[model samples]
Target: MKRSNCLIEVCEDFDCSSKRIKTSFIEGNNSSKMFRNTIWYRSLLDAEKSCLKEDKLKKIHYKFQDDKEMVEEYNVDTQVLLRRAWKVKGKLGGEGKWDVEIGDPMPDATPHIEGIGADFMESKDQPKLTRRNTRINLEWRIRNLPYPIETYSVSANNDERCIVIRTTNKKYFKRLQVPELDRLNLPIEQGNIQCSHSFNTLIIAYKKPQQLLDMDKEWYLELNRVKPIKDIPNDCKTQ
Candidate 1:
């Protein structure tokens, strides 16, 4: 299957006062070479593993579901997600760290304490722990193959977002027609396809507001193709 390396950027905007947050995946430049060995991608994988571990711990603590059943389910799920990650090892990689920045940091303005005065005082004293408006930027590389995506999902955990992309070998590549793709101005015919071998990328930003975590919240996604300079058509080539 033909493949190309594309850049993906997810920017999260959080507004503390209004309790609003917007998450967007921005399609950036592309190259013929796949960046499997970049620092950003490695960090993303590490963060994803951490998130999954935390999730497992939470499930064990809550006991909302059967532990045996949950473990079996996650075991299968982890295999699917990590299949591609294991293949990117032993390659020359890029350098750079994934960044997280807080915008307009401040103390909690609310005076009243929900618990005892001692607890309230301790909480109020920790300014850094208070929620505030923030922006998080995550960058990674994705290889667009000739197969179309079959199923995918994105979820947020406090400050991290996990993205899962899955496609079946039986499917054929078609024009990308999703509204989220249109919003990012990426062409459907840009070789933006996916298959089971595609790697999952994770982005962790500032904490998402509770209001924005509703099931109805909107998300934007775009897949841009990466092509070799020699293979790109003249019209699509950068001057």
Candidate 2:
């Protein structure tokens, strides 16, 4: 999906002399849409110590001086990122349950199998998006799907700029957009879409265009030229 109102920015300048860092996001295009949270530390090493996910939460705790405040901040940031990255929400299947989707268990209940006597918690083998050398691939495991390979239909809808997957019996459906193609203003071609089913899993691949490949090459070359900063002290510790 194309998001015209939101943009993600990563700050590259980390100066220990400032003794602070910011994790911020901007909504809308103009100056009126800034959302920011600053984190201060005694030194760069102190800031670095909070780089880990767990440590970041602890740092948020210190910043807000309360657990509730920390939780609200974390939730807001998480939701924003998830909405931006995961344009497609959880899929529905088999009487309204997720067959191959991203989800969390109920708040008070454990993730247990329906007929496994509650001993086996559902495994988290969620659908994943991966990139091969020349293609973007999506893999979804729906172990309960008993349909034959002939029941599935996977097609690229150039008008919608998305790949659509559907079953003849209406047991499953998904609409997936290629972020790379959308960002580059490229059209989705029906000829680039491929699909296969194996071992109760559906795999779809979209061949990458030459423009994307060229962009990747240039990005790698630029990354190699970025030198690591060596002067930041490591002795300063965070409490």
Candidate 3:
């Protein structure tokens, strides 16, 4: 199936006093559909009682349900909601309401935690991931190669659930995993991977699978419908 290659703009307005948060999503393409299929659960057992649409989640829930020890071990409240598309850390309120608070705000009045990305690195030699808003393919740039296009090779190792980058001369080698796909229980398919070299940088582009696209669409819609909190104290407002 063809994927819908569109970027979503997510805006979050949170109120710490009320422990409430509002998330909004604006799609680049106006034709995007909005869904209201929000499911809430206090724990694994609670989620198992509901109708979950995702197969991976279903399998996990079933496994836990069938095992008495596992059920007892995971029956406690976690203050987090796991859905087919995304996980929301908060308390489920009445009906569709949800109370979300990441943590205490910093002196600058911003939350301590932010979102995740493929580009985050701890060292300078690591491959840098670049997410393009105009395209659906994810790009990873490895600099300081100083090698021609034919000197490098990139391929997917599905058994390991990662993509391997290697130099023909054995000078450099790196294994990069797509954590986002792992959350969705997707495998690394060779057909969706491509690479090239430009200005001593080896760039690998992975086309997003259709399941991920649909997950994004669902996640965006749920966040867009969240109501914004009002009467936030001045200290809670960002500086």
RMSD of 2: 18.7
Better of 2 and 3 by lDDT: 3
Off by over 4 Å in 3: 1-135, 228-239
Report the Cα lDDT for residue 186, model 3.
66
Ranking by lDDT: 3, 2, 1
Q: What is the lDDT of candidate 1?
A: 0.23
Which candidate gets the maximum TM-score versus the true structure? 3
Name the weakest run of 10 consecutive residues (lDDT summed) in model 2: 79-88
Pairs with steric clashes in candidate 2: none
TM-score of each: 0.15, 0.42, 0.44
Over 167-227, each residue of candidate 2 has an lDDT whose tens digit, in order, gives 9999777787675566556688778777777766666667766655555444334333334
RMSD in angstroms, all models? 27.3, 18.7, 20.8
Q: Which regions of candidate 2 are displaced past 4 Å?
A: 1-146, 229-239
Clashing residue pairs found in predicted model 1 = none
Best by lDDT: 3
Task: Look at candidate 1 and tell me the lDDT of residue 95.
Answer: 24
Candidate order, TM-score descending: 3, 2, 1
